[model samples]
Target chain A: MLPVRAGIGLRHPHHREFLERQPPIGFVEVHSENFFGDGGRDLDVLGRVRADHAVSLHGVGLSLGRADGVDPAHLQRLARLVARIEPAVVSDHLCWGAIGDAHWNDLLPLPMTPAALDVVATAVSRVQDTLRRPILVENVSAYVQPDLADAMPEAEFVAQLVARTGCGLLLDLNNVYVNALNHGFDAQTAIDAMPAVAVRELHLAGHFVGPDCVIDHHGDRVCDAVWALHARFVAQHGARPTLIEWDTDLPTLDVLLEEAAHAQRILDRTRESVDA
Target chain B: MRDALAHWQRAFGAAIDGAATLPALRGDAATVARRFGVYRNNVRLARMAALRNAYPVIAALVGDAFFDGLARRFASTYASTAGDLNAYGAAFDAFLAAFEPAQALPYLPDVARLERAVHVAWSAADSAPFDVARLASLDAAAQAALRFTVRPGAHALVSRWPIAAIWNAHQPDAPHGFDFDAASPPYFALVRRDATRVRVDTLDAAAHALFVASAGGAPLADALDAVVAAAPHADAGVVLGTALRDGWFDDAPAG
Candidate 1:
């Protein structure tokens, strides 16, 4: 089982640190595509890191929310990696990234319509079948929720997905905060709509405050508002295995650990209250 | 894919691919339309970043602005079918070969091809070394008929320009006293990835002929004959010794 504590996303910069000295964190999550090579230097690096700590395979390329079927080859590759690594957690975002055969190679938004939900649910079910294990699907930050036909808000769509597909939710708090800010919705309300039991993990990442929208760049330090939201989130939803995701312009490993330490404080506080 | 999603993707793709207007989204039309630029810029940049990471030497050869422009153009022209972005730019060498903008740098395409091979070799499948003892135990006549397989991470490349020198010159620890512009004989590149580091060696004509032939599953005697025929003055012993050190041969076929 994944520990109910905080960990940082593993990037190339801190690989030496992890290999030489294991960090005091629960587990390290990696973008699965980076080590997707059949057998190579990158996989070797992953192997070394996996030995010292628990590893989570977080996928960015699966396009689980696409309307079309999941690519069998992609599934095959992912299955091979999963079989080899045996990660504590396996996940992809709750977003569509492909249209026809062309993959934008980015986490893209799906309309909150019934049709979109059907497409996403079907895709998730297919992936679950392929892996023969339940996978966590995270919410994505969208600049523009496309104009489309009937349905509910994004939260409702995701909540229904957990029920329909039996996949756990990787509730990305930053995405919720960014989406609420971009589309003028209450972030707490969105979180409230989610089924708490289904939320097995939480992602806390920094965003770039762009001119028009807050871009989920995963660069820099997490903002105060998001941290506050996380504190509130843990108090209400109860703590899960939260991850501090810092991608671009990565700081020193110590800096990442400090961020992880911050989340750990929140987790401990939440756990203490439950015990009390 | 449904009709609505497909239609949105068409407009969204066009908008990101070009200066086309953003597709109408569910929210405030004007605000959301303006905000869509983030995704547009991101998709374009993300694709460019993947290519840049794969072809760093090419990017270094061309300045940042030049590389960025080239990458963007490549991203716009080619639709990435693979879910993995790392596999998206496989056709970049071919694309660069025909690219009119880079016509001035004729050697650039070949360099790109060499770089792509290096990138691929880094992740190629693992292969055990050839059992030299088994080969030595065999009769000379038996050895003559034995076919050899190249290591999975090995790729052979031939280019007119000193591609190896150029690639090495750009390395952080480029050796002292090596000249990139000096005229030299054509070189055959033996690119191989052994565990951590990937090396690209410029092989002599004889070694190239012998190894290339051997890598393609040529029998021992025939391969040596090809090397002697290609360059009669070539040292046969040196060629064989180099091949052994380079982990070139998987002599024993899989049982």
Candidate 2:
């Protein structure tokens, strides 16, 4: 089981830092495809980190909502990695990134309709079958929300996904907040309708604040509003394995650890309430 | 419905692939265009950063602004078929080789190719080190017939320019040691993974010839013969000793 505590996203810049010091944190999460190569320094670094920390493999390029089935080669590479690491939690976005052979290399959101839901559910089942274990699918921050003719709400679509595939939800609260601002949805209400028990992990990340749009850039400190949303979700659904994700324009290791510590405090408070 | 999805996918691809025009999304065109611009920028910026990461020396050589422009152009022209961003720009070297604006810097393509090799060497599959003791045990005849397998992703690329010298000069951490030979000698870059880091070193002519031949699956005698054919002054024993000491080849049965 994934630990009900705080963790930080392990990125390339901090690999050397992690090698030199074991900071106070519950676990470390890494982008799964970074280690897709046969065997090399990144894999070696991951193995070393695994020895000391419970690792979560967060993937970005799975493209689970594609009309076609998931790519067999990408699935095989992911399976090999899961076998090698036996990570505490494995997760990918609930977004379609590629269309056939062209991979955008960015998580593109799915339409909140039955068709997209079926596509994602089928792909999630395929992934679970391949790994012989359930995986968490994260909600993505999207600029354009598809106004499909027969659209279900995002929460209902995700809940249906969980019900059909037996996979858990990686409720990215930051995405919820981002979407709320972008699409004029109530963030709390959307999250409140999710299958709470099926949420296996939570993601906290910083977003870029633009005048016209809020971008999920993961480059800055987590804003207060995202934290507030995360707090409400923890209060309602209980604590899961929460992660602090920082991608580009990375600060020093100490700054990342500082964010992780803030998350740790939240987890502790949430756990106390659950126990009480 | 599947075709509809594919159509939308293609439109989405067009929207993000450096096109200013909006695809026919299901929302208000004006609103959708403003919002969708975010995704377009995301795709362009993310892929640009990936290329920038993979080819830091090239980016440094061309300056940041020119590199960004080059990246945007590459992103527009090529579709990254692979899911991994690291694997996205396999065509970049070839793209640079024929790119019009970059024609001013003729050697940039080889430099791009070298950086890609170094990037590949960094994450290449690990192979067992060459066991030199096995070479001592073999009979002279069998030794000559012995084909060697080098560490994975280990090979030399022969270039018409002083590519190694140029690459070294561009590297932020590389020492200012290698002389930019005025003769503009063709360079052979030996790419190999040592411990946790990938090292791209300039090999002498004899060593380069041997690596080029052996990396292509030539036997020891054949590799030496190629070296002799290429340069009669090449010292076969010294180069062999150098390769062995560098853990270039794993002593395994030729399959």
Candidate 3:
């Protein structure tokens, strides 16, 4: 299991340095789809890195909220990978990306209606059953808000998913912050709605404020507001396995390490408070 | 997949694909379109990036603008069947073959094929070296009828254009004025991952035929016949020896 400390998302650029240095972090998270290949350099790197450090298989595919259902082929590949790696944690976004024949390969937002809730819960339960372990479902950053008239609040949708499926929540504070600004909701209240103990992991990433909406690009440093939100969450719910996720315009390993160190410091402070 | 939620997902997918105008999702039409554009942009950019990653040589040959346009067309023409983005552009070479604008560069399709092969080899499965000892232990008759399994990441590509030379020309350390004759002999390339890197080794027709036969599950004797048929004057024994030395076949028990 992942330690309740901080880790960095391991991207391609840092594979060599990450393996060589074996940085003193809690664990390293990788996109599960990236290593789904039968074999190759990425799998080799993952195997080597996993030998020493804890690993988290954060997936972008699986389309866990697909109305039709989760793709059995995709689920099988994920199961094969999970069996091989036995990662500290496995998670995918609570968004749909495919319908019928096509997969958009992006975390498209799902409506928060009861039917959509049933779709997500069924899919999540199927995935957990296949993997023989519960998986965490993360709240995706949304650009287009669903029809609020027919939909429940995003927090309630997520809470019901957890209560129904017995899965964990990967509380992405960055997504929470972005969605709050875009949809005109209070981020703190959204956090408050979650079952606190069900938050198995926390995600901290940077987003771009687009002209129309706040985009979850994950291309910059964690913003001050999100950091404050994270601190508040930790102060209230105690520490979780937090990750520093940077996907585009990736900086050197040092930048990610520094960010991870910052997160570790927050986690450490929470421990100190608990001790006192 | 026609439940109410599925209907909504399909409509949302259509809007993202530019198939249908902004569905009356939530909010006013203008406001909805503006917000929905974000998903469209993200999908296009992410899929385009996958194609760019798979076919860097093609991107370099065609400038970024042209390549981006081609990628957009290809993304629309072919549905992405795989959840993994890396597997998105397998049909790009086929698409480029009939692409109107790219027809000017007749060799572009072949180059795309070479790039796809390289991209695949970069992460293809690793296998143990061919077991020479096991092969030797077989009696003469058994050895003659042995059918070998091709190793993962080992592919033999024969193109009329000098695809290997074209790909090498675009490499980071390639010569400044590298050129190749379009009329040159067909290029037979063996693309394989050797522990550290995927290398493109140029081969004679006889050797190429041998590799192709092995990939097709032809017995050793029939593969040797294929080698002789491809190049009447070439030595089949020498070609087979080269294939063995290169570890083209997997060490798994032969069929």
Q: Which candidate should be chosen as best, given lDDT against the real structure? A: 3
Candidate 2 docking classification: medium
In model 3, which runs have C-alpha deviations exceeding 4 angstroms? B173-182
Ranking of all candidate structures by their lDDT, best first = 3, 2, 1
* DockQ of each model vs. true complex: 0.65, 0.65, 0.63
lDDT of 1: 0.83
lDDT of 1 by residue, B1-255 (tens): 376766776677667666557765776767776787787778888889889988988888888888888898998888788888888788888888888888888788888989889888888876677877777888878978878888777888888888887788777788754665446657678888776778888888888898888877788888888889888998786787778777776544832
Give the CAPRI class of candidate 3: medium
Give the TM-score of candidate 2 (chain A). 0.97
lDDT tens readout by residue for model 3, A1-276: 689999999999899999889889999999999998888888989999999999999999999888889899999999999998889999999999998778999998888888888888899999999998999999999877765246887778888998999999999999999988988889999889888888999999999998888989999999999999999999998999999999999999999999999999999999999999
A best-first ranking of the candidates according to their DockQ comes to: 1, 2, 3
TM per prediction: 0.95, 0.96, 0.96
Which residue pairs show backbone clashes in model 1? A147-B26
Which candidate number has the best DockQ? 1
lDDT of 1 by residue, A11-39 (tens): 98788777787877988899998887868
Residue range B1-255, candidate 2, lDDT tens digits: 555555666677777875676555555777778878888788888788889988998898789999999998887777778788889787788989888989998888888888888888888887777778888998999889888888887857788887777777777687766776667577778778876777778887888888878878888899999888878997898889999999888645663
* Of 2 and 3, the candidate ranking higher by lDDT: 3
